[model samples]
Target: MDPGSKLPLSPHIQIYRLPLTALLSVVHRATGVALALGAVLLVWILALAANSAEAYGQLYPHLASWYGQIFLLGLIFSLYLHFCNGIRHLFWDIGMGFDLEIVHRTAKFAIFAAIVLTVATWAIAANLEL
Candidate 1:
């Protein structure tokens, strides 16, 4: 390495904008992490179930509050996103859908589907709860 030679800079995140495929890949990983956290919440709910109905009854309303419901809805969105992305990956494993057009199109579809499914699921659940 010569001191006079400048090092080449790859477009770092601060400099380079990520494309839809790259952004969705990052979001997929983030959703995986969020799903783990959601799993922990489920475990807590399970513990309550195992302990006593009285225990869950005391906690249900708080879990039904605005923030809790928002978190649950976010969890649902993550589940759908992750599921869809996993299917995308399976297609990749089969050596399919690597074209830029397909990648971007599927990425957009996954995001849209996740939102739609989450909202639809919550709407149905709310109706049933009533």
Candidate 2:
């Protein structure tokens, strides 16, 4: 190695076009982490509810606010995505969906199912008083 030679740089995300399965794997892990974080919010709400109705009432308005709604939406999507991807992984454990085409199709379907299920869940919740 020459002392004056430029160091070789390793390939990075910018240098690679990740396949759909790779990207979805990343998203699945990310959503799993996000859901863990979201659990804190759920716990906070539960604690407030358990303490007193008055305390819960005070926090409820903020949760019902626009920013809160966005957070809930993100949480709901994360839940759905993680759940669907988990089912995908389960099928893999059962020795199914191993083909490259099947993998790609299932990844895409997971995303679509998450979106549809999240919307459906919110729709049903919206109609109820809770």
Candidate 3:
């Protein structure tokens, strides 16, 4: 091979079928990014809450809108997923739940827990009129 020439690269998921783990890995990172952004938003919310009622009033209406609610809901789900998966990773780091069956079961459990937590959060928020 010429020094300037690159070796042929094997085709990836775009050409071959990708596995669940591959897709889950991508989603995990994506959710992490979403959670980071959500954390920034959470800080803003806290700042607003700490400020005067007038300041919160100014921000609240925007946050109460449909678009804002949707964004918040997305953030909530992302945070839940990231949190659950983070715990799963901690368990893996401790040398537990590494078996193929256990890994699959844990992945499924994390997903279910995330959904449940997200929905429960929304329910409480609605009940509190927040």
Candidate 4:
């Protein structure tokens, strides 16, 4: 190795394309973070509810707003995605679904199932009144 030679660099982001499993792994970590933030928000809401009915009343409208509904939907999707991927990981831990084809198939299935579950959840929630 020449001391004056430039070090080799990894491929640029624009040139690198992640496979489905790799992308799912990244999404899993992101959703984990999102879920943590959602937990904090949940705690704050619970605290408000416990404090006074007035405080809860003040917060309810905003939460029921269109933008708030969108944020909640994203949170719900994140939860399902994280959950489905976690189960996939559990299966892998148990010495199953190790083949490359099986791995990709499960990754796709987990995503598809998560989407369906998220939609079903929101649909059911939309029908119930407080």
Candidate 5:
């Protein structure tokens, strides 16, 4: 409380880099939110299909455009990442994989698995179209 003495200041984000687990934790929450938002897109697509062919036709062109493809890809990746991270959390809920090393390994695996699953889903869908 003395004006003459300065208290130790906590490290700012610029000064302190987050650990991998901490960064992944943040991404996990972000992806969760992204997936929730993506559900709205899903509903819109379904509603368009249910209404009429003309209504669905209106949506198809936008979805087939490059920007729309990019948005769809991001949404797909977010869905996989959120699903993978949720499984990681389920293990934690059961008091498993608590070791620091195990935690780090699983964090890496979750990200890797999500990327793999996302790519595989796209590849399979593409093949189906052919």
Candidate 6:
């Protein structure tokens, strides 16, 4: 190796294409933050539920709005994704899902399963007569 030779630096994002795994990694962290915030929101809902009917009534209207619905939907999606990916991590802890092909396939499957579960949960919630 020539001590005076200049090493070529890697191309920047402007010249690079992000891969699925890279995107998923970023989404995982973002969803984790979302889930933490959702947990606080859930605690607020529980507090409302435990209070008197009049107090609960006051909070219910806000939650019935379209914006609230969207936030709830996003929380549900984040919860499912986090849960599914957590289980996948458990498998990895046991020394599985390390193979390149298996890792990609399982990650894809987990994402799909999370989406399906989130949709199913929302559908059931929508159908509830409450």
For TM-score, the strongest prediction is 5
For candidate 5, report its TM-score.
Answer: 0.90
Clashing pairs in 1: none
User: Candidate 6 overall Cα lDDT vs. reference?
Assistant: 0.84
TM-scores for every candidate against the unseen true structure: 0.89, 0.87, 0.82, 0.89, 0.90, 0.84
CA lDDT, candidate 3, residue 1: 56
Model 6 pairs whose backbones collide: none
Q: Is candidate 2 or candidate 6 better by lDDT?
A: 2
Q: Report the number of the highest-lDDT candidate.
A: 4
lDDT of the structure predicted as candidate 4: 0.95
Lowest-scoring 10 consecutive residues by lDDT in candidate 6?
17-26
Error of 3 at 108 (Å): 1.3
Which segments of candidate 2 are over 4 A away from where they belong?
A: 1-11
In Å, residue 45's CA in model 4 sits off its true spot by 0.9
Error of 5 at 76 (Å): 0.6
Question: Model 6: runs farther than 4 Å from truth?
Answer: 1-8
List per-prediction Cα lDDT, in the order shown. 0.89, 0.92, 0.85, 0.95, 0.90, 0.84
The list of candidate 5 runs beyond 4 A from truth reads 1-8
Candidate 6 structure quality by residue, lDDT tens digits, 57-121: 89887778999888788889888988888888899899988888887888898899999999999
> Which digits, one per residue and each the tens of the lDDT, describe model 4 over residues 61-128?
98899999999999999999999999999999999999999999999999999999999999899878
Model 6 per-residue lDDT at 68: 81
Error of 2 at 113 (Å): 0.7
Q: Rank the candidates by lDDT, best first.
A: 4, 2, 5, 1, 3, 6
RMSD of 4: 2.8
Instruction: Please give, for residues 1-130, the per-residue lDDT of candidate 5 as tens digits.
Output: 7877788656777888999999989998898888888988889889999999999999898987899889888999988888998899999999999999999999999989999999999999788979
TM-score, predicted candidate 6 vs. hidden true structure: 0.84
